[model samples]
Target: MAMAQNFRSAFHGFNREDVVRYLEYLNSKHNSAINQLKSENQTLTDELKALRAQTVSNPAAEAECARLQEENQKLLQQCGDLAGQIAKLQAQMEEAQKNKPLAEEELEAYRRAEQAERAAKERARQIYCQATGALAEATTQVDEAAEDFKLLSQRIATQMTDLQSTIDRSKEALTGAAATLYGVCSADTDSQ
Candidate 1:
């Protein structure tokens, strides 16, 4: 029964974000525990190596062995720290993945903002072109052209106000998305 249960869990790959977070917590705890065990293992191995080196029959061999032992101990200590670092990196990686939803949401929101900006720009272009064309058709010396120019100028002014409003709305949405993105990123960073 226990074996079947273990096998089931092994293939139970559909964990939710919140569940994954809990799994991350458990994994971090396990890594810390294993790291402690590795430290003890390294100590014992270093002691064994030192004992082996000391049993050599030559004085020069003993000196060389002592030097080598010191170097090995330093290397082992470095490895222990690196193991802890590996755990830290693993935790960070899991965290980044967990925050992917917020990042994806920001990406989507930015995409919408980009599309809105493009539409606004297109509208502005069309308005400017219409006004310019009308003004161009009207000659400065012709009364109709002069009158059309003034009207076009007025329309342009109005369109400018519309463009400003569109820009303001876009900025507001971008700002909100930026805030949410910043919150998610900062939360992960603080936890790490």
Candidate 2:
């Protein structure tokens, strides 16, 4: 909207005083806006710097990752021990089957051996199940860590983009204000 002017003033389509006053007001407003923009830019820049610094020190995530790795190693070792036990039991059973004994005492011993083999197999199966659960838990922790890192990176990226956009807008606003003030000052000087 244009500023209202009393055109009935002496020899004028619009009041020169009103035009000057409006221009002064505009120049002051632009100056104030420029100062505010500079302040906001500084604040945003500081916040971004702080965020970057925080990204550098994610010690908790690192520690968690290390702990998960250790757990995985332990689970793998347990799985290996269980596999060895299973193999040994299978070998013993096969040997017993090859040496067939007909005596009652010998048959009773064979039955006991079979029972022991079954117990060993069941224990191995239980250990295998435990190892599987541990592995899955480790995998889940790793995935959560990855997701957290990704979210932090995305947050940083978004902040950087916003800061850059504010800077660009401030620059454009300053440029436009400078051009407008220059035009007004030049016109005043020329009219003199």
Candidate 3:
């Protein structure tokens, strides 16, 4: 029998209802086939028993009896083959049933892993945003500090220019006082 391979997907895994329904369908078909084979085997066995009884009571129909026996043997062989097939099918079904839970567990593990990965990505994105904001704030503060330093340098340059002009005026005044004192001393000496 051909097995189904495709199943509908659900959020967590394959759709449970669809998988269960398919399994139930295959089981029903298998049971029916097994029952039919058993029924045919029983019918053949009954007929063979009846033929054997007839052969014992009536020895004149030996050729017909031999032919019937051959046909019965062939039928029995066919029934045995059918029984072997049924056994194999049952074994396969049992194996499938045994593995169902393991498959579900694996699918659950995959779902959990996917969720964790998404959470990690979200955390990384949040960190990136925070770092970018901090960088922008630091850049603004540095620009402000640089502007303040430039203004302070300009003010110090102006103060130095004013101090130099005061010093030049003081030097001229002292020179004029010295020249007047020398001229007064010379006049006094000549008059005496």
Candidate 4:
């Protein structure tokens, strides 16, 4: 999402609360995504264990489980990368705030920092969306695989029902976060 560059400039510099709040919001949103991914990973792991416990071994099901696990790992890695980027951005903001300079150079530096933060936020959002899509696809594949096994189908159907609810909640949370961000950005624009 494109945000205006205008920030409410204070006597000494741009409003610290505005910058801090924006960063905090991004951090919260990213953290939520990370937690959701972790929960899903755990669920998949549990399901894999259950599948293995069955006496009747299906090679195709095992292969599908392995693929899902690998995808979960990749998603986790992406989340870790995003988290690292957020921390770096937060550090840069804090450092900029501490070294507040009443000069044109300082204003330029602040602008650069803001731009970097925006880029990071955009990247995080993209990653979250991608991960969500991948998860839905994976779940569908799991459902399809479950159909081949009588016992597995019942278990997966129950799990999918629960997972659907979780996905719904995640989507709601994401929407709320986006709305909060828009409101914050709008307030900043109005303040200017």
Best by lDDT: 4
Q: Is candidate 1 or candidate 2 better by lDDT?
A: 1
Q: What value does the lDDT take at residue 69 in candidate 3?
A: 66
lDDT of 2 by residue, 76-110 (tens): 55555655655564565454445434334565887
Least lDDT summed over 10 consecutive residues: which range in candidate 1?
2-11
Q: What is the per-residue lDDT of model 4 for residues 110-179, given as tens digits with 9 covering 90 to 100?
A: 8999999999999999999999999999999988777768677787899999999999999999999999
TM-score each candidate.
0.34, 0.31, 0.64, 0.45
TM-score, structure 3 vs. true: 0.64
For model 3, give the 10-residue run with minimal summed lDDT. Answer: 55-64
| Model 3 score (lDDT) | 0.73
Model 2 CA lDDT for position 92: 52
Backbone steric clashes in candidate 1, count: 1
- Give the lDDT of residue 131 in candidate 4: 100
Q: Write the per-residue lDDT of candidate 3 for residues 1-192, one digit (tens) a residue.
A: 344666788755666656666666666775676677567667766766777777366665566666666766776677677667667756766766787888788889998999999999999999999999999999999999999988988888887788777777777777777777777888899889
Model 1, 1-192: lDDT tens digits are 222233223112423454455555556765765666566667766765766766558777667667766766676676676667667757766776786777677768988999999999999999999999888766545887678899999999999999999999999999999999999999999999
In angstroms, the error of model 3 at 102 is 3.5
The RMSD of every model to the true structure, in order and in angstroms, is 39.6, 61.5, 4.7, 53.8
